[model samples]
Target: MNFKDYIRVIPDFPKPGIRFKDITTLLKNGPAYQAAIEAMKQQVAELEIDVIAGPEARGFVIGAPLALALGVGFVPIRKSGKLPGETVEADYDLEYGKDKLAVHKDAIAPGQKVLIADDLLATGGTIETTVKLIQKLGGEVVGAAFLIELSYLQGRSKLGSVPVRSLVTF
Candidate 1:
C-alpha cells in the first residue's frame, strides 16, 4: 500500500510556513494502518527489541500497535506529569517549539533492548530525548521507527549512530 496516499498534508497548520503531515487520515484507514505497522515491523525485524517505547500521544498510537505486532511490551514516554510513580524526564526543542517528555523509572529494566516508535520524525529532538529517558532508566535503545520522516530537516543526524527506520520520508 502507498502510505503517503493515506497521509493528508495541511498547509500552515498551527503556524505559518509549515506543512503538517497528518497521520490521522492514515490511522483512520484500517488497512493502511496495518500496512504501515507491517512495514515498520519488517524494518525492526532484525533488531533484538524487548519492548517498544514511544513518546506520549502519537507515539502511543503508533507504538502500541507495533508492540502488539512484535509480541512485546509497550512503554509510553509521556509528558512531564502524565505518568505516575518515579519517572525520568528530558527537555528538548522541537521544530516549532519546545517541550518535555517523561517515562516511568521502571518502564524497562536494565539491559532491556528498546525500539522507539513515533508518527513523525522532524527535528529528532523528541526521539533523542526519549532515548535518554530510556537509557536513564537502564534500558538500552536499540533503534527507532517512524511513519513519516522529514529528511530535509536532518532529524536523523540528531539521532547519532542509533539505527532509525521510517516508512516514508520527505
Candidate 2:
C-alpha cells in the first residue's frame, strides 16, 4: 500500500519553514490505519518483544494498537507527573528547553524485551529519552517503530544501535 497517500502535509504548521506530515488523515481511515499497524507489525515480527512502550498522546495511538496486533503488552511512557505512583523519568532537550518523560516504575519487569513506538521520529530526542527510561527499569529496547519519519532531520542517528522502522518518511 502507498501509505503516503493517506497522510496530509501541512506547510508552515506550528511555525514557518516547517511542513508537518500529519497522520490523522490515515488514522481516521480504518483500513489505512489497520494497514499501517500491520505493516509495522511485520517490520518487527522477527524481534522477540515482550512489551511495547510509547510516549503519551500520539504515541498511544500507534503503540497501543501495534501492541495488540503483536499480541504483546503495551506500556505508556508519559510526561512527568502524568503517571501516578512511583515512576522513572528521563530528561531530554527540546528545541527550546528540556522536558521529561516518565513511566510507572514497574511498567516493565527487569530484562523484558521492549519495542518503542511513536507517531513520528523528528529529532530523536523523545525516543532517546524513552530508551533511557526503559533501560533504567531494566527493559531491553529491541526496536523502535514510527508512523512517519523526517529523514532530513537525521533523527535515527541519535538512537545508536536500536533498529528503527517507519511506515513513511519525508
Candidate 3:
C-alpha cells in the first residue's frame, strides 16, 4: 500500500509555514496502520535487535506492535518522571534551550542491540538523545526507523552514522 495516501497534511500546524503530516488518519484506518508497522518491521528485519525502544506518545503507537511482531520486547523511552523507579536521562537541544528524555535505568542490558522506532523523524534532537540514553546503558543502536520523515528539515544530518529509514518522506 502507498502509506503516504493515508497521511493527512495540515497546513501551518503548531506554527506558520509548517505543513504537518498527521498520522491520526492513518492510525484510524486498520489496514493502513498495519501496513505501516509491517513496512517498518520488514525494513529492520535484518537487524538483530534485542529490544525495541521508542520515545513516548507516538513512538509507543508504532513500536509496541512492531515489537510484538518481531517477538521481542518494547522499551518505553519517556519524558522525565513518566517512568517509575530508577531512570536515566539524556538531554537534547531545543530551539532556545534543551529538554530531557528518560528511560528505565536498566532498560537495556550492556551490549544489547536496540532498534528505535517512531511515527516521524523531525529535528532528530529527540532521536539523538534517545541514542545517547541507549548507549549510556551500553546498548548499541542498530537502526532508527520511522513511518514518516520531513527531509526538508535535514533531521537525518543530526543522526551521524546511525542508520535511519522512513517509509514515507516529504
Clash pairs for candidate 3: none
Candidates' C-alpha lDDT: 0.92, 0.95, 0.92
TM-score of each: 0.96, 0.98, 0.97
Q: Give the worst 10-residue stretch by lDDT in candidate 2.
A: 81-90
Put down candidate 2 lDDT per residue, 1-170, tens digits, no spaces: 99999999999998998988888899999999999999999999999999999998899999999999999999999999898889988899978999899999999999999999999999999999999999999999999999999999999999999999998988
Tens digit per residue, CA lDDT, model 1, 127-154: 9899888888899899999999999999
lDDT tens readout by residue for model 3, 1-170: 99989999999987998888999999999989988899899999899989999998899999999999899999999998899979999888888897889999888999999999999998888998999999999999999999999998888998899999899999
Range of the 10 consecutive residues with the lowest summed lDDT in candidate 1? 91-100
Error of 1 at 49 (Å): 0.4
Model 3 residue 136 CA deviation (Å) reads 0.3
Question: Which of candidates 2 and 3 is the stronger one according to TM-score?
Answer: 2
Candidate with best TM-score: 2
Write out the backbone clash pairs for model 1. Answer: none
